[model samples]
Target chain A: MHLLSIRDLVVKFRTHDGTVHAVNGVSFDLDEGETLGLVGESGCGKSVTNLAVMRLLPKPAGHIEGGEVVFQGQDLLRLDESEMRDLRGKEIAMIFQDPMTSLNPVLTIEEQMVETIRAHRRVSKSQARARSLELLTMVGIPKPETRLRNYPHQFSGGMRQRVMIAIALALEPKLLIADEPTTALDVTIQAQVLDLLQRLAADLGTAVILITHDLGVVAGMTSRLNVMYAGFVVESASTPDLFARPRHPYTVGLLHSMPRLDAQPGEPLIPIEGVPPDLRRAPVGCPFAPRCAWRLESCWTGMPSLEPIDQTAQIVTTGPNVTHRVACWNPATPDEAVAARPLREGFTPAAAPAEAVA
Target chain B: MSGVTGQPAPGAAVGVASTGTEPGRPLLEITDLRMYFPISSGILISRHVGDVRAVDGVTLAIQKGETVGLVGESGCGKSTVGRTILRLYRPTSGRIVIDGQDITWAEGSTLRAMRRRMQMIFQDPYASLNPRMTAAGIVSEPLEIHGVGSSSERRERVRDLLATVGLDPDYGDRYPHEFSGGQRQRIGVARALALHPDLIVADEPISALDVSIQAQIINLMERLQGEFGLTYLFIAHDLSVVRHISDRIAVMYLGRLVETATSRELYDRPIHPYTVALLSAVPIPDPAIERKRRRIILTGDVPSPSDPPPGCHFHTRCWLRARLGNPERCVVEAPALRELASGHAVACHFAEEVDGSPEQVLQVTGEGMGGSSSRRADDSPTGRVAAAGPGLAT
Candidate 1:
């Protein structure tokens, strides 16, 4: 059995404007020791999906309308608040993007970490403090003894993020949901944090759900990857299969849009040209049809379900149970994805429909 | 001048006429620019304890019509350098010369007039734009501040500017809150271009943007540069994006420049150890190359600029220093920015040793550049791919 199974998760947020469908029928599976990446632009429902899984969606406003988050045979959505609270930091932990905002300014590193440990495990203050110190040391905090006494404001951006990791792993959770964990850090510091996360997760045999918009980060850090669009998983595959052969037009556009370090210079980047879609009203068509380069007439009628693109892709996969899948009316061929242009002779780019833009 | 880098090459007259710069002079010349913030103790009778040397002893030259990228991690003063160049923060010492005029000490009308030729595009599009102001008002504010044209004329120009920056002219009436992040940034770009500035100091303009929207802004900037003969000081932390847009790239470490070269030259043949490590650290979006690469992950957080390590500011976290038997000279004498072959400049004591070392971290060879051949490192610490593409090559 899979470690975690999220089936058709549909999360909605009641805004002043309208009910925004934050996540629409997003489903995926996580193995015991897998690292899955969920990548997309802002408002693409990657974070909301994970938030729904953790049962940590904002109070009242955000609601999981329909979903079955089956974790180790128990439906996490059906769990009561008290049970959910017990599982939060122990079975599942989260690391937010900005450490400054996530951590309490008034509390010392010791107080916060010890409190988390004590809340989960029935340990005394000193024992919890010792575990906190050990975790800080494991995450490579210099002089954990003295650093633990320091307030959140005293640590540097990188050090503060390290402290956050230390706190999150204090209970040795089976699953970790890191939302843009290193986005606020610099390249070197990001490298350090990602390396630490990867190494520690491997050592602990922990499954990680790394939510970030950076393609480079997902490419290196994640074994399985999901490309998200406006409230939908547009594509899902193993890291190698996803990069080597992206079938979805949105995925292709993303691959071509980014300026790669190894890309040939002066090669013009083909950016997806349009404003991001509004989630206030759910569209009848594919969310990415407006920006897609390869779209068919059928794309405007209905949203395609996440289905397999290549059956043979799972044979040489890096991670377990990762099949190459995409949700699109007209998927791009490997040649089209690589060249980022039409394979046929008389091909024209897909224009945004008039109503879509307005 | 304590550490002036260079003079412009003789007989370079391409962009002089457009910008009114004298022949053989770069568009922007910075000499030993130092910006230090005072640290205080007591609230009422605060004693100046020390200085947070944000940008200390930096020199650079950007030719007319050139996009010079100043790249470094946070707290390395890349943004401070950009702000100091635009005179946002008055430098504690050194000179800033623009269009052959020394504006380091210029005040009142002179500073205002100098500001006309130079402008800045800030990092955060959301925070940068005034929420209360409409897009038209925000873009037209620069023109209005300079008293450039009549009310009607300014209105017309604002509409034109919006269209020029790829925004619909009709969207001018909407406030910043109404527009998306990408559209908001377009308004910011339009505002910067209102004064017809010769140099635009873009301080992490695209960093706040999404990966897809970033290309639109970069392409627009490139097109504008070509059309208006504009020079740019592109300050950013993303090495890949900086390389994509910049002609010359400068690497900063703890307020001082460690390496500067043409983007092609710097990536292919990095001399400074810090540059190599930085190149290695940036995770590229290619799984094939990522699987084979060996990241030289620097061990520690960057030291605080207020109390930067003596001698070499980077010696505290430098991977090369430890690999080189912990040289005493690195911790005793600060290296000056010395010119190497052609346009390349490096500030390092053991640069020759670095030049001779394996391109363990840097293997991103530019196509058609025959000088440096990229080959797989058989001795990479990480597992290696036999023949992956030469990208994400840490």
Candidate 2:
């Protein structure tokens, strides 16, 4: 069985403006010690989906309308508040994008780390302090003995993130969810932090869900990824396969939109025109049809289900070797993606309805 | 290199604010610009202990219609250089000659006039725009500030500006909160262009934008630059975006210009070790290329800029210096930004060693090395020298 499986998870926010459909029928599976990447632009439910997994969604507004978060053959969604709280720091750990905000400014590193370890393990304060020091060392902080007494404000941005990591991994959780861990860092420091996260996750045999917007980050770190748009997983595949042969037009547009480092100077970037769909009014049809170049005539009529690109792709395993699936009506071929044109003859979309206009 | 392609700019002689000077002179010239913020201590006494030295010394010249990119990691003072040149902060000492006029100490009316010729595009579109003001009111504020035209004429100009930035003229009635991030940035661009400025200081203009929206803004900026003959001082942390939009790129490290070269030259033959390290750190998007690339992951965080190291600000984390057995010269004296080629300059004692080295992006040590242990060990003589440099062979 997979380490974690999310089946048709739907989440919504009750805002003063109206109901915001943040996550809609999102489902994916993760394996033991596997690394999964969630890539998307802002407002795409990538962070919301992961937040639902930990049951840390804000109360009174964020409602998990429907879903099943199956972890270790247990329905984590059905767990009560106390049971979920015990599992939060012990079995699943999370690293946020802005370490300064996520970390407690008033508490010293020692206090926070010890509290986390002692809360879940029933260990003594001194014992928890020793484990915290060991974790800080593992995460490459200098002079852990002295640094432990330092407050969060004392450390630099990178060091604060390292301390956050050390605290997150204090109990050696089974799964680690790093939501844009390096987005707030400089490139040089970002490189250091990414390397550390990858190495530590490997050493501890921990599954990781790395959520980020940069395609470059996911390419180097995660084995498999799900490309999301408008609260739906538009595409999913192994890292190589996703980059090599992206079947979804939205994925193709995203890849082309980014200005690559290795690309020749003055190379023109083809932007995916038009803004994303509004989820306030629940997404209708394919949310990406307005921006997708490979839209079919029927794409605006209804949403497409996630299906295997090839008819013969087998579901033999649950990890990176899983089957490639796309939630696209008229998918792109390798040649179409290369030339950025519709190779399929019948996919020349008719006039889009005025109701879908941005 | 820029002189050849830069002279074709149409407004070199037609500059409305141009003073008596040679027409061939660059649009913006800054010499030894320094902006040191005072660090005060003791609330009762209010004593100035030291200066933060935000922008210690930066020198550059941007020709008419040339886009000069200033790039660095955050807090490296690239933005401070931009802000200082624009006279936002009173510089500690320097000369800023823009379009043959010295604006370094320009007072009141003169400074206000100088500001009209220079405009700014801020990083965050959300916070930059006034939430309560209408789009037309925001864009026309610059026109009203300068008393450029009548009320009706200013309204007409605002419409044209909005249309020029790809926003609908009809949306001028809407507020900033109603627009998306990209549209709000477009409104910001329109505001910057209202004064018909000769130079635009874009401070991380697209960093807060989404990836797809970033491309849109870049394209719009390029198109507008071509149409208006505008020179740009583009400051950003993203190396790839800077390389794409810039003709000449200047790399800053801890308030100093470490390297300045043409975009192609800097990418191909970077002389400064910091520039090389910065380039290697940017992750490429291709999985195939990433597998083969050996990244030089920097060991530690950038030091506090207030009390930067005496000799070389970057000596603390420099991979090339570590590879060179921790050269004593780098520790004793600061290296000047000396020109090695016609347009390429580097500030390093061992500039020759790093100029064309193939190990520019190659990995120094691929295995696990703790940040503290590696930084400490590199300082000692019994060192595990990161001895992988062809530069070191000589």
Candidate 3:
């Protein structure tokens, strides 16, 4: 059974500029103990969908217009404030990108961890402190007892992130949402943090919603992947399968856009031409149609629904019960995408046309 | 001035451009550059506690019409190297020569004249360009300052530069806030090329843009380099991005150069243990390669720059030391940058072992490189010190 299932989520932000359609009808399911990756570029609504699921969207500006986040046979959207608070840290916990901003500088590590522990359970101060130390030690912090007295400012960026992980895993929640947790870190430190996260998630048997823009991180960390483009999941597949064969043009573009460390010298990267669509205006047909190389006539007429490719094929044999889905009308094979190589060199500015001077 | 073992002392080359390349061959040459920010404490009379030695003894030369990529993690002094070369920060010591002219202490009009040949393309476009100024005003400001052209000619040149950078000439009236990240970066590029600079220091030019837009800027830069015959000192932390755009790549760690080689040679055969660990740490996009690759995960965090390790800066987190059973030499003696092959240079005492290069060959080669084999031990700890075998010879 699924651990957390998001259905038809539509998130909108009513800013003074305009009503921005941030997330448009996104739906996905996370199985028990599964590490799911939500990947996209900046302002692509990957974070918005996760925020909507946690009901932590900023008030007065962001709104969950439509959606039902069903977790463990309960509709999280319908839960009252008190009941929601009861489940937030106990059942589902979240860690954000920037550790400096996420952690309070004035508070010591012990205070924050113990407060989180006490808020979720009926534990004494001493008991909570003991558990906090144990949690800190579990996250690989050295000299946990002595380090707990130091404030957040005393810890380095990677150490603070480790503290955040320790606090989130204190209760051993059923689900953990990590939003770009290692983006602010260096590569070596990023590797250490991710290795810690992967091991912790596996040992605790906790499902994780890993949100990041890096495909490399997703490939190494997650079991299943969801590729988001312009507020929608354009493609979904198992990790190995997704890398082996990307069925969506957007996925193919993203893959080719990166300058591969394994690529031959002097090989040029084929970046997706044109910027992402403006969310202030409603999208027509397909949001990626303007930049997609495999755009068809139907792509220009209506948006395609996300559906499994050959439901009866059963071609993916690496993982059990794996499914590959794509929301592209004229999806190109890897060869075809490669054939569409080298997007016209410096094509007209993709954003705006040439201006006529007086 | 210090920490230079293989070459002549940096102080000895003061006021004189180093030889090897002809007088006016390379566009820029930095000899043992150093920039140290002082740390002080107390109220009335502050005492100097220490110094954050950024860009400690970095010597490099960039040929005309070639791109040299400087890459490292944060606080590794890669950005400081770029800033110091442009004279944005006065070097605490060493020489900076541009086209056979030393500008280390150029004052008054000499500094102003030096500015025309060298320009900087900053990392953050949103913060670098003034939001109040129009794109045209920002691009043509250099021409107006140098008094190169009249008002109408400057306007015409601004439009041409805008068009050259793949931006619409009509967008000249738009402010920085009016453009997207990619477009704003183009404006930054246009501004950098305003005076037809001979050298451009692009410090992480495309880092802030989206994945799709980064390619546009990179392609535009490559085209501009071909057209104008410009030299670039591209600084970035991303290894793949640096390898893709650079002719030669230098790896820095804790204010010291660890490795320098042609992009292909470095990627194919990294001799320094730190470079090997850094290359392995980068999670390749391909799942097959990522799963099958051997990762050398280093322990502990980077040491504070102000209190860096005495012998080797990377010794605190060196995976090679652990693999070699905590070598004592790594903690007691420093290594000098020594050439292993034609174009590959590494600054590690045990660089010969990382690539399994035969010890006999390295011994014969190291003798010619001067003092690189000075630390050959009497009592070999690894027990395979001078063992002869047909290993991979570069």
Instruction: In angstroms, give how far residue B279 of model 2 lies from its true place.
Output: 0.9
Model 1 clash count equals 1
Q: Residue A270 in candidate 3 has what lDDT?
A: 81
Which parts of model 2 have CA positions greater than 4 angstroms off?
Answer: A343-348, A354-358, B1-22, B355-363, B366-393
lDDT of 2 at A212: 94
**Pairs that collide, model 3:** none
Candidate 3 residue lDDT tens string, B114-202: 88788999999999999899999999898778776668777877888898988899999999998999999999999988766778999
Rank candidates by TM-score, best first.
2, 1, 3
Candidate 3 runs further than 4 Å off: A311-320, A340-358, B1-24, B356-394
Report model 1's TM-score to 2 decimal places.
Answer: 0.92
lDDT of 1 by residue, B76-138 (tens): 998898888888888999999998899988888899988989999988999999999999999
DockQ of each: 0.56, 0.54, 0.43
Q: What is the TM-score of each candidate against the true structure?
A: 0.92, 0.93, 0.89
Task: Compute the lDDT of residue A216 as modeled in candidate 3.
Answer: 84
What are the chain B TM-scores of all models?
0.87, 0.89, 0.85
After aligning candidate 2 to the native by TM-score, how far in Å is the CA of A1 from where it should be?
Answer: 0.4
Name the candidate that leads on lDDT. Answer: 2
Two-chain complex of model 3, DockQ on C-alpha atoms against the true structure:
0.43
CAPRI quality band, candidate 1: medium
How high is the lDDT of residue B250 in model 3?
94
